[model samples]
Target: MIRPDHPASFLEEGPFRTEEDQYFWKALVELTAMEETNQGNLAAFVGVSQGYVSKILAGKQVPKARLRRRFAEFFELAYEDMVALGRQHLESMGYPAEGLPGRRCQVREPAYGGAEAAGRPAAGQGEYSALRSMVRDLRAREAREGTYTEIPLREATASMGGGSTETGDRTLSYLSFRTEWIRSKGNPEYMTAIRAFGDSMEPTIADGSVVLIDEGRRQFVKNKVYYLRYNGQMYIKRLVDAGGRLGIASDSDNNLLLVSDADDFEIIGRCIWTARELD
Candidate 1:
Protein backbone atom coordinates (compact mmCIF):
# COMPACT_ATOMS: atom_id res chain seq x y z
CA MET A 1 0.00 0.00 0.00
CA ILE A 2 1.29 3.52 -0.87
CA ARG A 3 1.51 6.11 1.92
CA PRO A 4 -1.04 8.96 1.54
CA ASP A 5 1.15 11.33 3.55
CA HIS A 6 3.52 12.23 0.69
CA PRO A 7 2.22 13.30 -2.77
CA ALA A 8 5.51 12.24 -4.37
CA SER A 9 5.06 8.70 -3.05
CA PHE A 10 1.89 8.41 -5.19
CA LEU A 11 3.99 9.21 -8.31
CA GLU A 12 6.66 6.60 -7.47
CA GLU A 13 3.96 3.92 -7.21
CA GLY A 14 2.13 5.19 -10.32
CA PRO A 15 3.25 4.86 -13.93
CA PHE A 16 3.73 8.62 -14.38
CA ARG A 17 6.16 10.89 -12.50
CA THR A 18 7.74 14.27 -13.25
CA GLU A 19 11.53 14.71 -13.17
CA GLU A 20 11.50 18.47 -12.33
CA ASP A 21 8.81 18.29 -9.65
CA GLN A 22 10.10 21.17 -7.47
CA TYR A 23 10.47 23.63 -10.35
CA PHE A 24 6.99 22.77 -11.66
CA TRP A 25 5.33 23.56 -8.31
CA LYS A 26 7.07 26.90 -7.95
CA ALA A 27 6.11 27.84 -11.55
CA LEU A 28 2.47 26.93 -10.91
CA VAL A 29 2.28 29.10 -7.75
CA GLU A 30 3.88 32.04 -9.57
CA LEU A 31 1.51 31.73 -12.49
CA THR A 32 -1.55 31.49 -10.26
CA ALA A 33 -0.48 34.58 -8.33
CA MET A 34 0.27 36.55 -11.52
CA GLU A 35 -3.09 35.98 -13.25
CA GLU A 36 -5.51 35.65 -10.31
CA THR A 37 -4.72 38.93 -8.59
CA ASN A 38 -8.20 39.29 -7.08
CA GLN A 39 -10.52 36.95 -5.24
CA GLY A 40 -13.40 37.42 -7.71
CA ASN A 41 -11.29 36.40 -10.73
CA LEU A 42 -9.80 33.43 -8.86
CA ALA A 43 -13.26 32.29 -7.76
CA ALA A 44 -14.67 32.52 -11.30
CA PHE A 45 -11.75 30.61 -12.84
CA VAL A 46 -11.86 27.87 -10.17
CA GLY A 47 -15.67 27.73 -10.19
CA VAL A 48 -15.79 28.39 -6.47
CA SER A 49 -17.12 31.09 -4.17
CA GLN A 50 -15.02 34.22 -3.66
CA GLY A 51 -14.62 33.33 0.04
CA TYR A 52 -12.92 30.08 -0.95
CA VAL A 53 -10.09 31.91 -2.77
CA SER A 54 -9.49 34.12 0.26
CA LYS A 55 -9.50 31.13 2.59
CA ILE A 56 -7.04 29.19 0.42
CA LEU A 57 -4.68 32.16 0.01
CA ALA A 58 -4.81 32.88 3.76
CA GLY A 59 -4.00 29.21 4.56
CA LYS A 60 -7.26 28.88 6.45
CA GLN A 61 -8.52 25.96 4.30
CA VAL A 62 -6.99 23.42 1.97
CA PRO A 63 -8.32 23.54 -1.63
CA LYS A 64 -10.54 20.55 -2.46
CA ALA A 65 -9.16 17.82 -4.78
CA ARG A 66 -11.76 18.70 -7.44
CA LEU A 67 -10.03 22.09 -7.95
CA ARG A 68 -6.53 20.74 -8.68
CA ARG A 69 -6.89 19.96 -12.40
CA ARG A 70 -9.18 22.98 -12.90
CA PHE A 71 -6.50 25.27 -11.49
CA ALA A 72 -3.85 23.63 -13.68
CA GLU A 73 -5.92 24.18 -16.84
CA PHE A 74 -7.13 27.71 -16.01
CA PHE A 75 -3.61 28.87 -15.17
CA GLU A 76 -2.19 27.02 -18.20
CA LEU A 77 0.17 25.08 -15.93
CA ALA A 78 1.63 21.71 -16.94
CA TYR A 79 0.51 18.42 -15.33
CA GLU A 80 3.97 18.18 -13.71
CA ASP A 81 3.40 21.56 -12.01
CA MET A 82 0.18 20.34 -10.39
CA VAL A 83 1.83 17.15 -9.13
CA ALA A 84 4.83 19.06 -7.77
CA LEU A 85 2.59 21.57 -5.96
CA GLY A 86 0.59 18.74 -4.36
CA ARG A 87 3.83 17.02 -3.29
CA GLN A 88 5.30 20.19 -1.75
CA HIS A 89 2.07 20.97 0.16
CA LEU A 90 1.92 17.42 1.58
CA GLU A 91 5.60 17.44 2.58
CA SER A 92 5.27 20.78 4.40
CA MET A 93 2.30 19.46 6.39
CA GLY A 94 4.04 16.13 7.13
CA TYR A 95 1.12 14.18 5.47
CA PRO A 96 1.07 11.36 2.92
CA ALA A 97 0.42 12.37 -0.71
CA GLU A 98 -2.29 10.23 -2.31
CA GLY A 99 -2.51 9.62 -6.06
CA LEU A 100 -4.78 11.80 -8.17
CA PRO A 101 -8.44 10.85 -8.37
CA GLY A 102 -9.29 8.53 -11.24
CA ARG A 103 -11.21 10.01 -14.15
CA ARG A 104 -14.29 8.33 -15.66
CA CYS A 105 -14.68 7.91 -19.43
CA GLN A 106 -18.09 7.86 -21.09
CA VAL A 107 -18.77 5.33 -23.85
CA ARG A 108 -21.71 5.69 -26.22
CA GLU A 109 -23.41 2.85 -28.03
CA PRO A 110 -23.02 2.78 -31.83
CA ALA A 111 -25.96 4.14 -33.83
CA TYR A 112 -28.25 1.55 -35.53
CA GLY A 113 -26.59 2.23 -38.87
CA GLY A 114 -23.08 3.79 -38.44
CA ALA A 115 -22.88 7.61 -38.36
CA GLU A 116 -22.37 7.73 -42.18
CA ALA A 117 -25.14 5.22 -42.77
CA ALA A 118 -27.69 7.18 -40.68
CA GLY A 119 -28.10 9.67 -43.54
CA ARG A 120 -28.52 12.91 -41.62
CA PRO A 121 -30.55 15.56 -43.48
CA ALA A 122 -28.58 18.47 -44.95
CA ALA A 123 -28.45 21.83 -43.17
CA GLY A 124 -31.50 24.19 -43.43
CA GLN A 125 -33.84 21.35 -44.52
CA GLY A 126 -36.01 21.72 -41.45
CA GLU A 127 -36.14 25.52 -41.75
CA TYR A 128 -37.03 25.39 -45.46
CA SER A 129 -39.83 22.91 -44.84
CA ALA A 130 -41.29 25.16 -42.19
CA LEU A 131 -40.98 28.33 -44.33
CA ARG A 132 -42.64 26.68 -47.31
CA SER A 133 -45.70 25.94 -45.17
CA MET A 134 -45.90 29.52 -43.84
CA VAL A 135 -45.69 31.03 -47.33
CA ARG A 136 -48.75 29.06 -48.31
CA ASP A 137 -50.75 30.61 -45.47
CA LEU A 138 -49.37 34.13 -46.15
CA ARG A 139 -50.40 33.97 -49.83
CA ALA A 140 -53.96 33.19 -48.78
CA ARG A 141 -53.93 36.18 -46.43
CA GLU A 142 -52.47 38.46 -49.15
CA ALA A 143 -55.29 37.50 -51.49
CA ARG A 144 -57.82 38.76 -48.92
CA GLU A 145 -55.93 42.09 -48.50
CA GLY A 146 -56.05 42.64 -52.31
CA THR A 147 -52.94 44.83 -52.26
CA TYR A 148 -49.16 44.30 -51.89
CA THR A 149 -46.66 46.32 -49.87
CA GLU A 150 -44.67 48.83 -51.94
CA ILE A 151 -40.85 48.70 -51.93
CA PRO A 152 -39.00 51.99 -51.24
CA LEU A 153 -36.21 53.48 -53.37
CA ARG A 154 -33.22 55.89 -53.21
CA GLU A 155 -31.62 58.08 -55.88
CA ALA A 156 -28.02 59.21 -56.60
CA THR A 157 -26.51 61.31 -59.40
CA ALA A 158 -23.59 60.08 -61.55
CA SER A 159 -20.84 62.62 -62.32
CA MET A 160 -20.00 63.27 -65.98
CA GLY A 161 -16.46 64.29 -67.08
CA GLY A 162 -16.14 68.14 -66.92
CA GLY A 163 -19.17 70.19 -65.75
CA SER A 164 -21.39 71.08 -68.74
CA THR A 165 -25.14 71.72 -68.90
CA GLU A 166 -25.25 70.51 -72.54
CA THR A 167 -24.57 66.89 -71.46
CA GLY A 168 -27.52 64.96 -70.09
CA ASP A 169 -27.32 64.16 -66.38
CA ARG A 170 -26.60 60.51 -65.46
CA THR A 171 -27.97 59.00 -62.25
CA LEU A 172 -27.47 55.83 -60.14
CA SER A 173 -29.93 54.77 -57.45
CA TYR A 174 -30.95 52.01 -54.97
CA LEU A 175 -33.45 51.28 -52.15
CA SER A 176 -33.69 53.42 -49.02
CA PHE A 177 -33.38 51.74 -45.59
CA ARG A 178 -36.83 51.05 -44.03
CA THR A 179 -35.97 51.01 -40.33
CA GLU A 180 -38.99 53.05 -39.23
CA TRP A 181 -41.33 51.82 -42.00
CA ILE A 182 -41.72 48.25 -40.75
CA ARG A 183 -44.32 48.32 -37.94
CA SER A 184 -43.50 44.72 -36.92
CA LYS A 185 -46.59 45.20 -34.66
CA GLY A 186 -46.45 42.62 -31.82
CA ASN A 187 -44.45 40.02 -33.77
CA PRO A 188 -40.88 40.42 -32.46
CA GLU A 189 -39.35 37.82 -34.77
CA TYR A 190 -40.42 39.60 -37.98
CA MET A 191 -37.48 41.26 -39.78
CA THR A 192 -36.73 42.72 -43.21
CA ALA A 193 -33.64 43.11 -45.43
CA ILE A 194 -32.96 43.63 -49.14
CA ARG A 195 -32.55 40.50 -51.24
CA ALA A 196 -29.40 40.89 -53.38
CA PHE A 197 -29.40 37.98 -55.83
CA GLY A 198 -31.39 36.46 -58.73
CA ASP A 199 -29.75 33.13 -59.52
CA SER A 200 -32.92 31.36 -58.36
CA MET A 201 -35.30 34.35 -58.22
CA GLU A 202 -34.50 36.23 -61.47
CA PRO A 203 -37.49 38.53 -62.20
CA THR A 204 -38.81 38.45 -58.60
CA ILE A 205 -35.52 39.73 -57.11
CA ALA A 206 -33.13 41.79 -59.22
CA ASP A 207 -29.40 41.56 -58.44
CA GLY A 208 -29.15 45.06 -56.93
CA SER A 209 -32.51 45.22 -55.12
CA VAL A 210 -32.72 44.80 -51.34
CA VAL A 211 -34.85 41.98 -49.81
CA LEU A 212 -36.57 41.81 -46.45
CA ILE A 213 -36.51 38.36 -44.81
CA ASP A 214 -38.49 37.14 -41.81
CA GLU A 215 -36.83 34.80 -39.33
CA GLY A 216 -40.06 33.79 -37.58
CA ARG A 217 -42.06 31.96 -40.28
CA ARG A 218 -41.13 28.33 -40.81
CA GLN A 219 -43.89 27.12 -43.14
CA PHE A 220 -43.57 26.84 -46.91
CA VAL A 221 -46.11 28.60 -49.19
CA LYS A 222 -46.45 27.25 -52.71
CA ASN A 223 -45.53 29.71 -55.53
CA LYS A 224 -43.99 32.35 -53.22
CA VAL A 225 -40.51 33.89 -53.25
CA TYR A 226 -38.15 32.51 -50.60
CA TYR A 227 -34.44 32.62 -49.90
CA LEU A 228 -33.12 29.11 -50.47
CA ARG A 229 -29.93 27.12 -50.76
CA TYR A 230 -28.92 24.12 -52.89
CA ASN A 231 -25.80 22.26 -51.85
CA GLY A 232 -23.74 25.13 -50.33
CA GLN A 233 -24.95 27.86 -52.68
CA MET A 234 -27.75 30.29 -51.68
CA TYR A 235 -30.72 31.17 -53.92
CA ILE A 236 -34.03 33.02 -53.80
CA LYS A 237 -37.01 31.53 -55.62
CA ARG A 238 -40.71 30.76 -55.49
CA LEU A 239 -41.43 27.27 -54.16
CA VAL A 240 -44.55 25.40 -55.33
CA ASP A 241 -45.95 22.22 -53.83
CA ALA A 242 -47.09 20.06 -56.75
CA GLY A 243 -49.13 17.68 -54.61
CA GLY A 244 -46.33 15.79 -52.78
CA ARG A 245 -43.63 16.98 -55.22
CA LEU A 246 -41.58 20.24 -54.80
CA GLY A 247 -41.20 22.61 -57.73
CA ILE A 248 -39.04 25.77 -57.88
CA ALA A 249 -39.75 28.76 -60.14
CA SER A 250 -38.07 32.09 -60.97
CA ASP A 251 -40.03 35.34 -60.68
CA SER A 252 -38.78 36.53 -64.08
CA ASP A 253 -40.19 33.56 -66.05
CA ASN A 254 -43.03 30.98 -65.84
CA ASN A 255 -40.76 27.90 -66.12
CA LEU A 256 -40.79 25.57 -63.05
CA LEU A 257 -37.90 23.46 -61.64
CA LEU A 258 -38.44 20.12 -59.96
CA VAL A 259 -36.68 19.48 -56.66
CA SER A 260 -36.74 15.68 -56.02
CA ASP A 261 -33.78 15.56 -53.63
CA ALA A 262 -34.19 17.48 -50.38
CA ASP A 263 -30.43 18.09 -50.29
CA ASP A 264 -30.60 20.29 -53.42
CA PHE A 265 -32.38 23.19 -51.69
CA GLU A 266 -32.57 25.05 -48.35
CA ILE A 267 -34.56 28.11 -47.30
CA ILE A 268 -32.26 30.68 -45.67
CA GLY A 269 -35.08 33.05 -44.72
CA ARG A 270 -38.37 34.38 -46.14
CA CYS A 271 -38.45 37.47 -48.34
CA ILE A 272 -40.57 39.99 -46.44
CA TRP A 273 -39.40 43.24 -48.10
CA THR A 274 -37.74 44.30 -51.33
CA ALA A 275 -36.24 47.69 -52.41
CA ARG A 276 -35.41 48.78 -55.94
CA GLU A 277 -33.89 51.96 -57.40
CA LEU A 278 -36.34 53.97 -59.51
CA ASP A 279 -34.89 55.05 -62.85
Candidate 2:
Protein backbone atom coordinates (compact mmCIF):
# COMPACT_ATOMS: atom_id res chain seq x y z
CA MET A 1 0.00 0.00 0.00
CA ILE A 2 2.93 2.35 0.62
CA ARG A 3 4.22 3.84 -2.61
CA PRO A 4 7.63 5.39 -3.12
CA ASP A 5 7.51 9.19 -3.00
CA HIS A 6 10.11 9.41 -5.79
CA PRO A 7 10.10 7.40 -8.98
CA ALA A 8 13.07 5.32 -10.09
CA SER A 9 14.09 8.03 -12.60
CA PHE A 10 14.51 10.48 -9.76
CA LEU A 11 16.72 8.20 -7.63
CA GLU A 12 20.53 8.31 -7.68
CA GLU A 13 22.55 5.50 -9.12
CA GLY A 14 24.37 3.46 -6.53
CA PRO A 15 25.13 -0.15 -5.48
CA PHE A 16 21.65 -1.34 -6.48
CA ARG A 17 19.42 -0.58 -9.46
CA THR A 18 16.76 2.01 -8.68
CA GLU A 19 13.76 -0.28 -8.25
CA GLU A 20 15.62 -3.02 -6.41
CA ASP A 21 17.29 -0.49 -4.17
CA GLN A 22 14.00 1.19 -3.37
CA TYR A 23 12.32 -2.10 -2.50
CA PHE A 24 15.17 -3.01 -0.18
CA TRP A 25 15.31 0.35 1.56
CA LYS A 26 11.59 0.96 1.56
CA ALA A 27 10.86 -2.48 2.94
CA LEU A 28 13.30 -1.87 5.74
CA VAL A 29 11.73 1.49 6.56
CA GLU A 30 8.19 0.17 6.56
CA LEU A 31 8.93 -3.08 8.40
CA THR A 32 10.83 -1.36 11.17
CA ALA A 33 8.76 1.79 11.44
CA MET A 34 6.51 0.04 13.90
CA GLU A 35 9.43 -1.16 16.05
CA GLU A 36 11.88 1.73 15.62
CA THR A 37 11.48 5.28 16.79
CA ASN A 38 12.83 6.89 13.62
CA GLN A 39 15.70 6.90 11.15
CA GLY A 40 17.95 7.48 14.14
CA ASN A 41 16.70 4.32 15.80
CA LEU A 42 17.30 2.35 12.64
CA ALA A 43 20.70 3.97 12.14
CA ALA A 44 21.72 3.02 15.66
CA PHE A 45 20.49 -0.48 15.08
CA VAL A 46 22.92 -0.89 12.16
CA GLY A 47 25.83 1.02 13.74
CA VAL A 48 25.54 3.66 11.03
CA SER A 49 24.99 7.40 11.16
CA GLN A 50 21.50 8.81 10.69
CA GLY A 51 22.64 10.54 7.51
CA TYR A 52 23.63 7.16 6.08
CA VAL A 53 20.16 5.82 6.75
CA SER A 54 18.65 8.92 5.17
CA LYS A 55 20.81 8.55 2.08
CA ILE A 56 19.79 4.93 1.76
CA LEU A 57 16.12 5.71 2.28
CA ALA A 58 16.23 8.63 -0.13
CA GLY A 59 17.82 6.34 -2.75
CA LYS A 60 21.02 8.33 -2.63
CA GLN A 61 23.22 5.42 -1.47
CA VAL A 62 23.49 1.75 -0.76
CA PRO A 63 25.11 -0.38 1.91
CA LYS A 64 28.81 -0.31 1.06
CA ALA A 65 31.64 -2.65 2.09
CA ARG A 66 31.01 -4.24 5.49
CA LEU A 67 27.82 -2.26 5.98
CA ARG A 68 25.93 -5.08 4.30
CA ARG A 69 26.51 -7.29 7.31
CA ARG A 70 25.47 -4.57 9.69
CA PHE A 71 22.34 -3.89 7.68
CA ALA A 72 21.46 -7.56 7.59
CA GLU A 73 22.13 -7.83 11.29
CA PHE A 74 19.77 -4.97 12.04
CA PHE A 75 17.07 -6.88 10.21
CA GLU A 76 18.23 -10.02 11.97
CA LEU A 77 18.74 -11.33 8.41
CA ALA A 78 21.82 -13.38 7.63
CA TYR A 79 24.68 -12.06 5.53
CA GLU A 80 23.71 -14.35 2.64
CA ASP A 81 20.18 -12.99 2.31
CA MET A 82 21.39 -9.41 2.42
CA VAL A 83 24.10 -10.03 -0.14
CA ALA A 84 21.66 -11.94 -2.36
CA LEU A 85 19.72 -8.72 -2.87
CA GLY A 86 22.85 -7.10 -4.27
CA ARG A 87 23.76 -10.07 -6.45
CA GLN A 88 24.24 -7.77 -9.42
CA HIS A 89 27.08 -6.16 -7.51
CA LEU A 90 28.47 -9.59 -6.84
CA GLU A 91 28.36 -10.67 -10.49
CA SER A 92 29.71 -7.33 -11.72
CA MET A 93 32.40 -7.03 -9.06
CA GLY A 94 33.24 -10.70 -9.52
CA TYR A 95 32.21 -11.62 -5.97
CA PRO A 96 31.82 -15.40 -5.68
CA ALA A 97 28.68 -16.74 -3.99
CA GLU A 98 28.68 -20.45 -4.52
CA GLY A 99 27.21 -21.63 -1.21
CA LEU A 100 24.26 -19.24 -0.90
CA PRO A 101 23.63 -17.75 2.46
CA GLY A 102 20.78 -16.98 2.78
CA ARG A 103 19.54 -16.92 6.32
CA ARG A 104 18.92 -13.99 8.52
CA CYS A 105 21.73 -12.61 10.72
CA GLN A 106 22.87 -14.93 13.45
CA VAL A 107 20.32 -15.81 16.06
CA ARG A 108 19.35 -12.70 17.98
CA GLU A 109 20.76 -12.73 21.49
CA PRO A 110 17.41 -12.01 23.07
CA ALA A 111 17.69 -8.70 21.23
CA TYR A 112 16.02 -10.46 18.28
CA GLY A 113 14.07 -13.60 17.74
CA GLY A 114 13.13 -16.00 14.93
CA ALA A 115 14.69 -19.15 13.44
CA GLU A 116 18.15 -17.57 13.36
CA ALA A 117 18.07 -17.07 17.11
CA ALA A 118 16.65 -20.47 18.00
CA GLY A 119 19.94 -21.70 19.50
CA ARG A 120 21.85 -18.45 19.70
CA PRO A 121 24.42 -17.83 22.39
CA ALA A 122 23.52 -16.16 25.64
CA ALA A 123 23.36 -12.38 25.98
CA GLY A 124 26.18 -9.92 25.27
CA GLN A 125 29.45 -10.09 23.35
CA GLY A 126 29.39 -13.87 23.22
CA GLU A 127 26.60 -13.60 20.70
CA TYR A 128 28.11 -10.70 18.78
CA SER A 129 31.42 -12.53 18.62
CA ALA A 130 29.76 -15.55 17.03
CA LEU A 131 28.43 -13.26 14.33
CA ARG A 132 31.92 -12.61 12.97
CA SER A 133 31.79 -15.93 11.16
CA MET A 134 28.44 -14.98 9.69
CA VAL A 135 29.93 -11.74 8.46
CA ARG A 136 32.87 -13.64 7.05
CA ASP A 137 30.58 -16.13 5.32
CA LEU A 138 28.59 -13.25 3.92
CA ARG A 139 31.76 -11.66 2.63
CA ALA A 140 32.65 -14.89 0.92
CA ARG A 141 29.14 -15.25 -0.40
CA GLU A 142 29.31 -11.80 -1.89
CA ALA A 143 32.84 -12.11 -3.17
CA ARG A 144 32.34 -15.51 -4.74
CA GLU A 145 28.75 -14.83 -5.82
CA GLY A 146 26.43 -17.32 -4.15
CA THR A 147 25.87 -20.74 -5.65
CA TYR A 148 22.53 -21.16 -3.91
CA THR A 149 19.11 -19.59 -4.40
CA GLU A 150 16.23 -18.87 -2.06
CA ILE A 151 12.87 -20.49 -2.71
CA PRO A 152 9.96 -18.79 -1.08
CA LEU A 153 7.61 -20.78 1.16
CA ARG A 154 4.19 -19.42 0.70
CA GLU A 155 2.22 -19.70 3.90
CA ALA A 156 -0.22 -21.51 1.57
CA THR A 157 -0.75 -25.25 1.54
CA ALA A 158 -1.26 -27.38 -1.57
CA SER A 159 -3.76 -30.17 -1.26
CA MET A 160 -2.86 -33.78 -1.97
CA GLY A 161 -6.36 -35.17 -1.52
CA GLY A 162 -9.75 -34.72 0.17
CA GLY A 163 -11.37 -32.96 -2.77
CA SER A 164 -9.84 -29.47 -2.97
CA THR A 165 -7.86 -26.94 -0.93
CA GLU A 166 -7.05 -23.25 -1.13
CA THR A 167 -3.50 -22.15 -1.75
CA GLY A 168 -1.69 -19.51 0.23
CA ASP A 169 -1.28 -16.42 -1.94
CA ARG A 170 1.23 -14.59 0.23
CA THR A 171 4.90 -15.36 0.47
CA LEU A 172 5.46 -15.94 4.17
CA SER A 173 9.21 -16.59 4.05
CA TYR A 174 12.15 -18.19 2.20
CA LEU A 175 14.45 -21.21 2.33
CA SER A 176 17.92 -21.22 0.83
CA PHE A 177 19.99 -24.12 -0.48
CA ARG A 178 23.12 -24.65 -2.49
CA THR A 179 22.52 -24.43 -6.22
CA GLU A 180 24.99 -27.25 -6.66
CA TRP A 181 23.18 -29.26 -4.06
CA ILE A 182 20.01 -29.19 -6.12
CA ARG A 183 21.24 -28.61 -9.69
CA SER A 184 21.50 -32.38 -10.12
CA LYS A 185 17.95 -32.52 -8.89
CA GLY A 186 16.48 -29.61 -10.83
CA ASN A 187 16.83 -25.93 -11.68
CA PRO A 188 17.42 -24.02 -8.45
CA GLU A 189 15.54 -20.94 -9.58
CA TYR A 190 12.46 -23.01 -10.31
CA MET A 191 12.25 -24.16 -6.71
CA THR A 192 9.61 -23.22 -4.12
CA ALA A 193 8.35 -24.64 -0.82
CA ILE A 194 4.71 -25.34 -0.11
CA ARG A 195 2.97 -27.23 2.67
CA ALA A 196 0.88 -30.31 1.77
CA PHE A 197 -2.65 -30.81 2.97
CA GLY A 198 -5.09 -33.75 3.06
CA ASP A 199 -4.36 -37.48 2.80
CA SER A 200 -4.56 -38.27 -0.87
CA MET A 201 -0.85 -38.86 -0.96
CA GLU A 202 -0.89 -39.92 2.71
CA PRO A 203 1.98 -42.12 3.93
CA THR A 204 4.28 -41.10 1.11
CA ILE A 205 3.63 -37.41 1.65
CA ALA A 206 2.07 -36.64 4.97
CA ASP A 207 -0.62 -34.06 5.43
CA GLY A 208 1.81 -31.57 6.94
CA SER A 209 4.86 -32.16 4.82
CA VAL A 210 6.81 -29.24 3.45
CA VAL A 211 6.99 -29.91 -0.27
CA LEU A 212 9.68 -28.45 -2.48
CA ILE A 213 8.41 -27.83 -5.96
CA ASP A 214 10.29 -27.22 -9.21
CA GLU A 215 8.27 -24.61 -11.00
CA GLY A 216 10.17 -25.20 -14.21
CA ARG A 217 9.31 -28.89 -14.43
CA ARG A 218 5.71 -28.55 -15.43
CA GLN A 219 5.73 -31.11 -18.25
CA PHE A 220 4.45 -34.49 -17.14
CA VAL A 221 7.12 -36.93 -16.02
CA LYS A 222 6.17 -40.51 -15.37
CA ASN A 223 5.88 -41.71 -11.78
CA LYS A 224 6.90 -38.34 -10.35
CA VAL A 225 4.73 -36.31 -8.02
CA TYR A 226 3.87 -32.79 -9.09
CA TYR A 227 1.91 -29.80 -7.91
CA LEU A 228 -1.25 -29.30 -9.93
CA ARG A 229 -4.23 -27.00 -9.87
CA TYR A 230 -7.68 -28.23 -10.82
CA ASN A 231 -11.02 -26.54 -10.43
CA GLY A 232 -9.37 -23.61 -8.64
CA GLN A 233 -7.85 -25.98 -6.09
CA MET A 234 -4.28 -27.21 -5.77
CA TYR A 235 -3.14 -30.83 -5.35
CA ILE A 236 0.02 -32.89 -5.44
CA LYS A 237 -0.09 -36.15 -7.40
CA ARG A 238 2.24 -38.52 -9.14
CA LEU A 239 1.75 -38.06 -12.86
CA VAL A 240 2.60 -40.04 -15.97
CA ASP A 241 3.04 -38.82 -19.51
CA ALA A 242 1.02 -41.03 -21.82
CA GLY A 243 2.09 -39.80 -25.21
CA GLY A 244 0.35 -36.45 -25.54
CA ARG A 245 -1.97 -37.10 -22.58
CA LEU A 246 -1.40 -37.03 -18.80
CA GLY A 247 -2.43 -39.40 -16.05
CA ILE A 248 -2.42 -38.36 -12.36
CA ALA A 249 -1.97 -41.03 -9.72
CA SER A 250 -2.38 -40.82 -5.98
CA ASP A 251 -0.15 -42.79 -3.67
CA SER A 252 -3.11 -43.60 -1.45
CA ASP A 253 -4.44 -46.04 -4.05
CA ASN A 254 -7.00 -43.51 -5.19
CA ASN A 255 -8.31 -43.47 -8.76
CA LEU A 256 -6.31 -41.69 -11.45
CA LEU A 257 -7.49 -38.83 -13.62
CA LEU A 258 -6.66 -39.58 -17.24
CA VAL A 259 -6.51 -36.57 -19.51
CA SER A 260 -6.46 -36.74 -23.30
CA ASP A 261 -5.02 -33.23 -23.47
CA ALA A 262 -2.12 -31.79 -21.47
CA ASP A 263 -3.93 -28.52 -20.93
CA ASP A 264 -6.77 -30.01 -18.90
CA PHE A 265 -5.08 -28.87 -15.64
CA GLU A 266 -2.46 -26.42 -14.55
CA ILE A 267 0.88 -27.79 -13.47
CA ILE A 268 2.03 -25.58 -10.64
CA GLY A 269 5.31 -27.41 -10.19
CA ARG A 270 7.02 -30.76 -9.56
CA CYS A 271 7.69 -32.03 -6.08
CA ILE A 272 11.39 -32.45 -5.46
CA TRP A 273 11.67 -32.69 -1.69
CA THR A 274 9.17 -33.72 0.98
CA ALA A 275 9.82 -32.91 4.65
CA ARG A 276 7.42 -33.74 7.43
CA GLU A 277 7.42 -34.14 11.19
CA LEU A 278 7.75 -37.73 12.33
CA ASP A 279 5.30 -38.93 14.89
Query: In lDDT terms, which candidate is top?
Result: 2
TM per prediction: 0.33, 0.48
* Error at 277, model 2, angstroms: 2.6
lDDT score, candidate 1, position 72: 63
Candidate topping TM-score = 2
Tens-place lDDT per residue, model 1, 1-279, is 233444444245432244343323333333444332455666798899977665444333445446755656665443444565444533543442343321111111112233333254332345234323433444454443333333222131111111111112122333333334444522323443432633335555665566666646546877666656555455556788877888766666666768767565666556666656666
Candidate 2, 145: how far from true, in Å? 7.4
* Candidate 2 similarity to native, TM-score: 0.48
Worst 10 residues of 1 by lDDT: 156-165
lDDT of each: 0.46, 0.62
**C-alpha root-mean-square deviation, candidate 1:** 23.7
lDDT of 2 by residue, 1-279 (tens): 222333233244344544444335533433343233356767888788988777665545667647756776676556556544444322433323332111121111122233234363333335333333544566576544456667798876787775456676688888777767878888776778988887889788988899999899887668888888876677888887656567778888867777654444788888988888688
